[model samples]
Target: MGRYNFKLPDVGEGSAEAELVGWQVEPGDTIVEDQPVVEVMTDKASVEIPSPAAGTVVSVVGAPGEMLAVGSVVLVLEVDGPGNAGDEAAPSVVQPQPETPPAAEPPAGTERTGAPAGEGNYVFKLPDVGEGSAEAELVGWQVEPGDTIVEDQPVVEVMTDKASVEIPSPATGTVVWVKGAPGEMLAVGSDILILQVAGPGNMTAAPVSSEGPSEAPSPAAVAPARATVVPAETPERRAASPATKPGFATRTPGEKPVASPAVRRRAWEHGVQLQFVPGSGPGGRITQDDLDAYVESGGALGTGAPTGRQPKTGTEDVKVIGLRRTIAKRMQDAKRRIPHFSYVEEVDVTDLEALRVTLNAQYAKDRGKLTLLPFLAKAMVRTLPDYPQINARFHDDDGFVRRYDGVHLGIATQTPTGLVVPVVHHAEALTLWECGAEVARLAAAAREGKASRDELSGSTITITSLGALGGLATTPVINYPEVAIVGVNKMIERPVVRGGQIVVRKIMNLSSSFDHRVVDGWDAAEFVQRIRALLETPATLFVED
Candidate 1:
């Protein structure tokens, strides 16, 4: 028997590692070529790794939940000779080889200089754009199936960890098919679109007079023209440039602008005309900061006015798929397998807000600004010692609870694609400034869809805040394997009794959900109350240490 080692290929774009979500076949199982052998969960999406060569599964290198680096030997297979195994009837599996066609004799109308007559057809596969990005979201399609497309025409828009990028057509041709729909995730090297050239109609149109002397056309006889014939713009190319129509104002001759899709969307939502804004970015590109400054200065469109209208309502039936789908499955599993309890409390943050303003200005340059998240993260780290149960994870098989001494705070951030929680390792050890910087970095990466697999995994506890959503309070679902999660609500001005008279104070709500089987309700409530007290009396956080 011949042994074939099938290592884990680079599944996602630029992904270095992947978590083993599941194994389809175990040792000694007979598997066919192209059969899925394992399911791997990368930061981008969960993908099933198929067998490259047909063989019997000899052994698996790792267990579920263990991370495997790219190119690592995931499994070994023992196979009989090619003809004796399941691959017997399969077509020859040979490595790709480039073929050069035989040179054609000089035609009557053209000279044969050995250069290929027409551009060779190329198959455009999905490209890996981000680290650990396995699949990409099909956001939009510029060229439809069966439409004649030109080379470099934007064929589709795919969302990766970097941003939504437009995949251009490789060669001019009629698009034969599109493999996936909008919002669908396509794996790397997958054939996204197929094209058929308009040139070769049939083999019957050959040389009518093959017997005649193969004489090349005379240079003097060839008519020389000042202008060249440009191919007619196909429908696909026309569709790409919406501003190319008549009467549309063309951009002034200058450097081109650069802005992300999200930034452009935000500009559209604010009803700001981008053409009028004096961009400060490189090459005169409008940036998010420029947009913000324009809005602050009341410079152009919708200045000093309310934002644009709400988006049109539409019922979206999105299948639980991709990273969001995995998150849902894990959450459901956590709720079913682990007993959970929640605790809620309201806190006055009047003094905390004042302190935040002072510290923000004090460390303005080094540490952008001090947000409530870092302060709360610090408070949680300090209060965990009092209620260790809240920091413990339940190990049902062993009938023992696993408690952690240091806090790995998972900060949840929402992106255009879905929700991602990037962990801040050893939160207790980080200073307030360091914690703030980490939070800023992680949140920005999460929002921009650039968080790595390690950054999004292995958290002891989680914190989710929807202060931007303007909700009073919410019980956040606990991110599984970990025992508890804390939620932060909007800070609003409310009437409060100060000594004897009514006073206005800024109050915020805090809520927590814990594994009841591991942590008692009393411990959960006490832990939340401790965090609330720190926020209410901001001085206590600094004084207690």
Candidate 2:
């Protein structure tokens, strides 16, 4: 049996490194070709890395939850071929290129030579995949060693923090070498693969070289065609002063710009030259605001005077990371995409509360004791038939709205993992007892992080509550794609006119929001009125279908 060092193949574009989410197979397990062996997660996707050739798992290289660079070795396998009997070492790494200073100006009279059609060796460099993306995880390779590929053929998948992208072959050639295995993170514009082009007769193009001398000039190796001033390393200049050297305004030769990594990332994202962006920092260091102002004003880099913005104090840096990060994105998307109209209506739930208390006294063995939430959910489902817009989803770009026949009620629960909404499917068909039980079950599962993917998604409409901790009103952001959300406020006893007499009534606010794009003010107001009507009469809620 041949020992194969199965490197983790590049899975998708911009994937420099991936978090190993799970493993389908363990060491000593037999696996077949195309069988899923492991699952890796990038910010964009959770992808299953499949086996290329059927083999036995000799070793597993990465642990679950470990972040692995693209092209890193993730497994060792024994292949069936007799030739595989030979021992193979780990995947080879591309030799690091020597850092070169950015030149101020190119030598005059250097003519441009486009892509070569003729034969010879060409080292294909990994091109810049996305803005601000300096490195990416190699997802998988499309061609193997010795495979003949044509120009523009898809070559590999890369995963960036933003998205996954497919890279295409630069020229039609024989694949002689492949670089990096899946899950290995590679820098942009680094040597990734090598190709042997058939030498063309009467060739007009130069052979792309991986090295100097006999090798043809590689375009990637050439510095940017821009005038640059490399600071001279003079004795007088060296001893003169540290501030005199172009440390801030000008970048150090062969060194990265003098800015924080975040500032540098911002510059990259905006396609702004860090050197061109005049720094307003100490000793003229580039700052994030400088880059932002520069890009905002059409490359007017230095014109942005500092606003009265003060640096934050007494603030600890809490990164928006992991599940919390994802929640932020969704909440932001919902608020940004949906034009929400908030409506707060007072509902006298004194009767409803009484009914709940009476029922829970006997509900000791059934539905785990009903609460106001179940009653609210039932009231919503009952009122949805007359006002279906409240129980629907809206796709703005498609201009299509889906009003569901079934109430897949989403219960927004705050958990240790963050705010999670788990769906109770067919909530309309469920009895009051079922709704309460389902809410209890879903809430427990969500809080424990054991809710299934389906349970956490596809919610038609949602209900959020703070229970006893609820305030007078809350304008909750609509859960994305869904048009409405019901927020329950705390019940307060206040003086009210009951039958023309001053009396204390248990009143609560049903603070809710609706997407104005799909739900009109009239429709929204009328819908809440229906809920208020049913909720006020308490008995009407149970009598309705």
Candidate 3:
């Protein structure tokens, strides 16, 4: 009999370090070849290292939460037939060595068995998207297996509590396998897709148990035919009633608490400390319900002390993963990369509001309800012919501006999943009624997380509104490649002087943000003035573009 020293292989991101997250097998646990032995988290993604050969686990080198590097022996196994002795293998197990290229293997704790694929397989694990993200819901896949794809092309969209993310391909190859179905949640370092390439590939995927972990990297477990990707508030995050408030769990000003990644994310969002609230789960494990109960009961709320009757429960830790991570990254990028100039124009929409009411009443029977947004969209599209700068896309890396002849306007819609902007292609070609209908359709699709890639992207410009809840005017951020964004503000009635007479008029503000690099202040203001004029003189709405 011989002993084998299984070292940690490269998880693919150039980094040599990974954090030992969990161990699937302990000392003396008999494991099979390719069985997941431990899970490790890298900077880029999380992965589960499988046993290279079937044998009894002699010793687990590192405990959970320990940092391990590539080439370092993570575990030792006594195989029925092997070369090395156990005593000799155990000494060099913890020694660090040069980093190797990461393989496509599952992280320290993940593998493929569910959603069996066709033909050659190359599984790509999901990465640790920083900011404490662990799992994300499978929003959609951009490419199907058997399709040839170039490197860096987007492959899938995953939704997390923080934001929605578009995961790109790691290499240029043919996709041979895909695991999860739509609306399923995958952990940060589990196998997401399999690409068949000419060179090396990840470990082969084998069938796993029907019941295992849905997100966490567990090789023995396989997801069902359709697994539910519950949002943070699903029954999964539930805690004992009236004990703790999940929504109120905040970031305490001390060491991080012992909460799951999901609960940690929830606590971070609410700005409450985990220590302030109590845990209801086993061994001080905090559940989402406990956090919510604490919130309802008014926990410390950043004070580190619950003045309003602190519940004896505990706090949970949820990782900020998936869609939420994507949102945070994109929002940060837009703000940091682009120079924005905000322009606000107050319009006497008294006439425009009247026109809207009349039109809604007229179309109430056949067409759906109409809001000022449709009018605003029509006005922007019509006015774009006069000022083309606002309706454009800029490629910063290429330093080139792409001006589109057609108006593909993006409407930012918020759903329970996250915020998504659905595009209305050729807005200039549509009538106001058509615009309203298209907006409604796109908004519905986005809210349902069913908007196609084309519907979600390719906007020359964007328009945002908070409806009646729009608190005055807002300075909207430019939608990256798009040079400008127009925001619709709340409409309120106040006294105004038109013909030397103080009278009440429906007033609203058009707040616009433009890329100062492309659009000048004079042009920005004039474009908005034109929108205001079109809305005030509703008769101009019939003008052909």
Question: lDDT of each structure?
Answer: 0.64, 0.67, 0.68
Ranking by lDDT: 3, 2, 1
* 425-504 per-residue lDDT for model 2 (tens digits): 99988888888999999998876545755677799999999989899999999999999998999999999998999999
User: CA shift at 518, candidate 3, in angstroms?
Assistant: 0.6
Task: List the lowest-lDDT window of 10 residues for candidate 2.
Answer: 225-234
User: Model 1, range 349-446, lDDT digits (tens) per residue?
Assistant: 89999999999888878767888999999888989988877776677777887888988899988876468789999998998889999999988877
TM-score sort, best first: 1, 2, 3
Summarize candidate 3's per-residue lDDT along 309-393 as a digit string, tens digits.
7667655444445455667788888998889999998989888878788878888679878888888888887899888878998
* TM values, all candidates: 0.52, 0.51, 0.49
In angstroms, the error of model 1 at 99 is 12
Highest lDDT scorer = 3
| CA RMSD of each candidate after superposition | 15.5, 14.6, 20.6
- Cα deviation of 387, candidate 3, in Å: 1.4
